[model samples]
Target: MTNTEITIHTDGSCLGNPGRGGWAATLRRYEGGKEVKKRSINGGVKHTTNNRMEMTAAIQGLKKIKKGEKAQITVYSDSRLLIQGMTDWHHKWQTNGWRKAGGKPVENRDLWEELLTVTDELNVQWEWVRGHAGDRRNEEVDAMAADAAYKAA
Candidate 1:
């Protein structure tokens, strides 16, 4: 069976650093070089951080793929922390028992572990997009996240 191809754009918004926050993800599937299917998901919490929301977006987006489905997924996000953590820091953190430099336990370990679990079940490539710079997909998720945050407020 041929592996499916999917692109996911994710974004997060926060009204306050530790206040209302939301996350959004947009998933598009391409078949035969043509757009085939698309979906958007979003949610928010009464109190959260932007980083947490960012990671949540990624986790939610990846979860859309069914278990054991074969797919090549490219995940796009504006948060450097999310991208860097997945591509780089996660290894070191895992090696050190989920502790960061200076021996501080990794912030957002729950979300980080969830993200890792979802990613491990799929073939995923991480991409960083400059947020609010006119990337249509990225902007769409950003708006969705902001709207969700406002609604949750």
Candidate 2:
């Protein structure tokens, strides 16, 4: 298993509550002047949340890499809430049996747990990107996600 570092961009969109939603992830690896781009999408769901889409993007991206290969991935997303929850509050939630403080069940616990499992399989470094503000790759992913959501509707 060769160790390769992949720069990945991800985005997700939801049309309305219990409405259409989608998530897209793009993986790019540059060798000299050549860049390989691979995209994946998840849709076809009747009811979903934007957070679920966001988490799905990350999970799908991680799912692409082969096992036992060292992957250094930088995942870009505009969702600060998702990033913080994964890097910060997840520990507390797990210790508390996936419940938040005050003993309330956490939102999207299933997706969060799934994401954690997929991410743990690889070496991922999560980063933040401002959505719809002209980052070309991120914008492309945003378009893909929106289209996927609409198509699934």
Candidate 3:
């Protein structure tokens, strides 16, 4: 609401590829390049994929923006699939009726659609960060997600 841009860092963790999973998002608002506000949210499920948790983190993070608050958002994640899908691949998939180039249904169509809906409500930019590369915020969310996954398990 203050016209200050908000940045969100998100991560997801799974015990196994298709095992208990968790996701986390940390949001920050900066003014004059100084962080003025911060909040974190996390959740987990007994059965899910890392990809699903990754998308969930982004969706839940974006949802934290208050309604009617029009602020530019930049989302950072280590998941290339999440970032690339949202920034590039989703358009083609949508145009092709949610099917991949090979005529196979997009694996996470539901989450993709939900992400699109949430993103449409705001101005968003996607950024990819390498996981475990020492980015402080990224590392924080990574730990948060891992802890959540363990708790869920």
Candidate 4:
């Protein structure tokens, strides 16, 4: 069977550094060159940081995948922190017990761990895009996250 191709676009927003925060993800499934399914999800926390929200967007997006299925998944985000941490720092962090340089614990380690676990289960490709550009899907998710944050405020 051919591998299913799933594309998820994600974004996060925070009112303030330690204020209301929100995350959004848009999932699209393509089979045989035709789009099959699509979904959008978003949520917020009463108190959280932008980094936490960024990690939450990725985790929540990956969590939508069906279990026991081998799929080629690509996650697109604007957060360099999330993209870099997952693609580069994850291995080092794992070896260091989630600590960064100077033995400092990684922020959003909880969500990072969860994202790592979820992405490991699927063939995930991490993609970084410029934010606030003309990417419609990214813009949509950004708006969603912002609206969710607004509601939580």
Candidate 5:
């Protein structure tokens, strides 16, 4: 993996809350002009929630960064649930033994753990983008996710 700083746009889509779901991540950078790299990650599951799909998108996208790559990745997502879960709630969840208040189990604990582990292997910066705001990268990933969901359905 190149050491170049990578900007990633991620998104998740679902045909229904318990129906086909998809996730996507698009990596972008142009430090080397025509030689610059652009890569995308996208997939779907038959039964899932939008939140789960959102988490999956982050997981798959972050996993694309090789173990040894020192690339600093900025992940932009339209899902506030994902962005806030990672940036805000995850630390508390860890401290609480992955439980929420009142001892409720954290939802998507498996994916959250995976994301944390992968993020530890790289420099990651998370940001939130408004969905359907016409940001090119965000739109691209959104479309990719929708397409993946369509295929899965």
Candidate 6:
């Protein structure tokens, strides 16, 4: 039996911060070359932030993975906040009991908790990419997210 790894490219878009948003994720199975399974979803909260959209994208991406599989996964996203928060800030926050510096409660604690829980369930490698840098895969996810945001509005 061969161990298979999967790569997921993700992006999120918002028409206006605290207005409309969309999220997209593309999963490629590493068996032959790159067999893709793409997913995009969007919704306008009437008042939602870009960071929320970005977080939503990550959560949605992780949700797509099948259960009970020993798979190595890489999640690529353009949101530095999402990547850093997940890999770095999350630990700090947890140590502080989900509070920010000065002992203030963390913003978006619910989303962060969900992200942490889901990520912990998977063998995932989180990566950050520079948005709009003409990276084809990145750009494709971005476009899908943006389109979903528009159509959902």
lDDT of each: 0.92, 0.80, 0.94, 0.89, 0.86, 0.80
Screening candidate 6 with a backbone cut-off below 3 angstroms (N, C-alpha, C), the clashing residue pairs are 18-48
Return the top candidate by TM-score: 1
For model 2, residues 61-114, the per-residue Cα lDDT tens digits are 777866654656788899897778877989999999999999999998988888
Model 3 local distance difference test score: 0.94
TM-score of each: 0.96, 0.87, 0.95, 0.94, 0.90, 0.88
User: In candidate 6, what are the lDDT values of residues 55-120, reduced to their tens digit?
Assistant: 888788788887555789898999999899877888889999998778899888899998877777
Output the TM-score of candidate 4.
Answer: 0.94
Please state the error at residue 32 of candidate 3 in Å.
Answer: 3.4
Put down candidate 5 lDDT per residue, 104-153, tens digits, no spaces. Answer: 99988998998899888687889999999889889999999999998995
Q: Which stretches of candidate 3 lie over 4 Å from their true place?
A: 1-3
lDDT of 5: 0.86
Candidate 1: segments with Cα more than 4 A from true spot:
1-3
Candidate 3 matches the true fold with a TM-score of 0.95
RMSD of 4: 1.3
Q: What's the candidate order when arranged by decreasing lDDT?
A: 3, 1, 4, 5, 2, 6
Could you give me the TM-score of model 1 versus the true structure? Answer: 0.96
lDDT of 3 by residue, 25-96 (tens): 999998766789999999999999999999999999999887656677899999999999998999999999
Write down the lDDT that model 2 would get: 0.80
User: In candidate 1, what are the lDDT values of residues 1-153, reduced to their tens digit?
Assistant: 444699999999999998899999999998766789999999988999999999999999999988765777899999999999999999999999999988999999999999988887688999999999999999999999999999884
What is the lDDT, from 0 to 100, of the residue 115 in candidate 4? 87
Question: For candidate 4, what is the total of clashing residue pairs?
Answer: 0
